[model samples]
Target chain A: MELFEEQGFEKTSAVQIAQRARVTTRTFFRYFPDKEEVLLADADADAVKETLVQHLLQKPDVTDTLQAVTRTLADFDWEKLGPRQILRQRDAMIASDPRLLERELIKQQQLTDALRDVLCRRGTAPDIAELAANTGSQVFRTAYRKWLEDNNDGDLTTITENVMSLLAAIMARGPVPATAARLP
Target chain B: MELFEEQGFEKTSAVQIAQRARVTTRTFFRYFPDKEEVLLADADADAVKETLVQHLLQKPDVTDTLQAVTRTLADFDWEKLGPRQILRQRDAMIASDPRLLERELIKQQQLTDALRDVLCRRGTAPDIAELAANTGSQVFRTAYRKWLEDNNDGDLTTITENVMSLLAAIMARGPVPATAARLP
Candidate 1:
């Protein structure tokens, strides 16, 4: 991270990262394929998929897919990922470049697909699984953004709950039409 | 459209497209700088941005940003875009190529940014506006997928409304915890 902050993500090499950690270049390769992997590829998508599906499967009696989906998101232990300040800095670094952002988006799309497939394997209907996966990913993304604040010490679980709660609150309040521009 | 459908988006040449259309290459350049623009550039982002902003501006009394955002989306006239079969074909063409999908996602991101800017201009808090824009875009994406079915004759406006309503309904039901896999 220090090297990335100093020389930018593009300029930094995986060997330099490994050297700093007093490890062999081969060791670094074993863990992450490249320097980009160090920052953005830390999250194990397969583990996340398993965790989410397991949560949904545990509650077979709960027929509402969306509810189970959001709960699965809210139940994840986000603090284990890393410190909030470090994560925020990482996010800022990724956001600085369009290519990096595109890569991140592609990763997100893959995660959505993984979740969708897991839901299908668990016997959820295809259409419902698709919706659940997309919506669940959005909920996690929204909460993760909320979780990245400097003063905000909220963990992933609480933040996820809060986001879902906000969705519910806004839905009940409904759309306000008066503020929209009316043509003369 | 016929040329692209027959030869694929990448394989077809602009000269061939122009010749097939009974127009000179010069005329084709005048209308669209390239052939890919023929498929990917139909939905003018500027026009969509203006429409969305105007809708939000007209109703100064509507304080709910999400409501205004979704309503602005629902206000788009879908039928004017052309017949369902043609639109479906276009979507399929785009879906077949990863580059086309990336372009589409980038366009969606731009729309989200446009909405966020419009909401901030309307006195909504910056954070709230950002959230509203992201959420609103998701609503549109989900509804648009549903609207693309071959036998589904549902208009975009109704589909958008139905998606938003479903969100409200799901939120009312709350999350179901038992179906989730046990942490143990």
Candidate 2:
């Protein structure tokens, strides 16, 4: 993150990064094939999928299945890292370039797909599974955004609950139907 | 799409594309900075938002607002590109690599944000706006997937309606609260 901020991600050389960390270029190469890998180091879509699936399997009810998945996600702790390091790395990666952003977005999509698969396995109607996964992901995202803003205060579980409630209200209200006459 | 399929996006030289398309490289550059641009083209986020806003303003009731937005979205017709070309391009882009897939996700995210903004502008609560937009996008995506599979026969309006009904049912059978039970 420091290197990326000092000199652009495109400009920062692997050799320079190794030198700064007092490691050999060979050692750096062993850890990451390219500099971009450093930004994408936290890519763990499979692990998340596994966690969600395990939780879903334990719950038979469809709604319980979703709640279990949400609960599992809320339990994740990205706090082991020093707060300063986490913020710096996040900012550097997202603000650096389009490529990094694209990679991050792809990882998120993979996570969403995994969630959808879990829903399907739980016997949700195919279309319902797709909608549930998509809706669940959006709620998770909103909760994450809130958590990031004030990580010191609210728990992820609480924020997620609020998001879920809000989603329920919106669903109850529902979108306007097409058969309803259109306004001029 | 043909250029990308015939020659890899990276390997296909700009000069070759211009020659094959019977246009100067300058003209190609004017339209797209790179070959990747051809696959990434879609409805402008701002235009879609503007259209939704216009639709919302026409509606007298909050219930009609989302329906209006769905109607506007359904009415959109991609300029003269046959169904086959659309399907091929969509499949090729997503299948080619993760990068393109990421861009597609980001594009969808942008659309969601625009929809949320439009909803908020039309007097919906902030949380409701966000939830509505997320749900609406999910509906649109489900409908689109079905439409694509069925050779794009169904209108977006019908797809949106199906999705909305699904969401309503899910909420009617609301899941147990996540906070109801504490971790043992």
Candidate 3:
């Protein structure tokens, strides 16, 4: 991240990165195939995806697709994904560059696809599965963003639960209406 | 689109496209800078953004943010964005490939950002604006997919309205409950 911030991603090479970390170039290559991978690295999406799929496939009784999806998602231990501070830095770097941001969106879409696939396999209605998967990811994103802002030690699971509870309340209340006619 | 379908997008050359259309290379370049632009050629996102921003700024009292957003969105004539058949083809080409899919996601994010900006400018809470913008875009997407699958002459506006109405009813009912033991 420091290298990226200082010299931009395109200018930084693997050898420089390896030397900065006091690791051999061969060691760096063994860990990361390319310079881009150093920033894009994260196995968390697959981890969360496998967990959600297993949970849904094992217990089809969770008829409420949204609840089941949310439960599975909220239970994820984010630590297994990566270090909290590094993950945050990775997100920040991704946001700072359009190409990286596109990669992030691609990752998000992958998660959505995983959720959608599991929902469909559980015999959830196609349309409902689409909505549930989308909503689950949306809630997860909202919670993740909040978690990043709150504190370094913030618990993502608790934050996710809060996000879902808030969403339920908001939907129940519906959109707030204006007092009078106001469109031009 | 026929050219793209015949030969993959990457394989098709601007000169060949120009020759097929009986236009000079200069004419082709004048219209599109590259081959990819043939698919992502529309400025539809900006046009809708402008309309929504103008409507929101002029009539802040139109309370119900989703309602207002959808109404403004529905008012757009699909023809203005591009020919119906061509738009469908463009969407198909985008969906057929992962790189194009990423571009589509980036476009969707751009629209969301525009909606978020206008909503925040109108004094809506930032977080609420983010959620509303995402929901509005999701509804737009659902309507678009249905329109593509339905009759060729279907009106996008009507489809959008139906989507929004369906969403309202679904939200009112909430998610279905599980029939068996819930997740631990």
- Against the reference, the lDDT scores of all candidates come to 0.65, 0.61, 0.65
Clashing pairs in model 3, backbone N/Cα/C closer than 3 A: A178-B63
Among all candidates shown, the one with the greatest TM-score: 3
Most DockQ-accurate candidate:
2
Q: What lDDT score goes with residue A50 in model 3?
A: 76
Q: lDDT for model 1, on a 0 to 1 scale?
A: 0.65
Q: Which CAPRI level is candidate 2? A: acceptable
- Global fold similarity of model 2 (TM-score): 0.67
DockQ (model 2, Cα): 0.24
- Candidate number with the higher DockQ (2 or 3): 2
For model 2, what is the alpha-carbon lDDT of residue A125? 63
- Measured over all alpha carbons after superposition, the RMSD of each candidate to the real structure, in angstroms, is 10.1, 9.0, 9.3
Kindly report which residue stretches of model 2 are placed more than 4 angstroms away from their true locations once superposed. Answer: A1-46, A57-65, A80-97, A175-184, B1-71, B78-85, B88-92, B176-184
Quality of candidate 3's docking, in CAPRI categories? incorrect
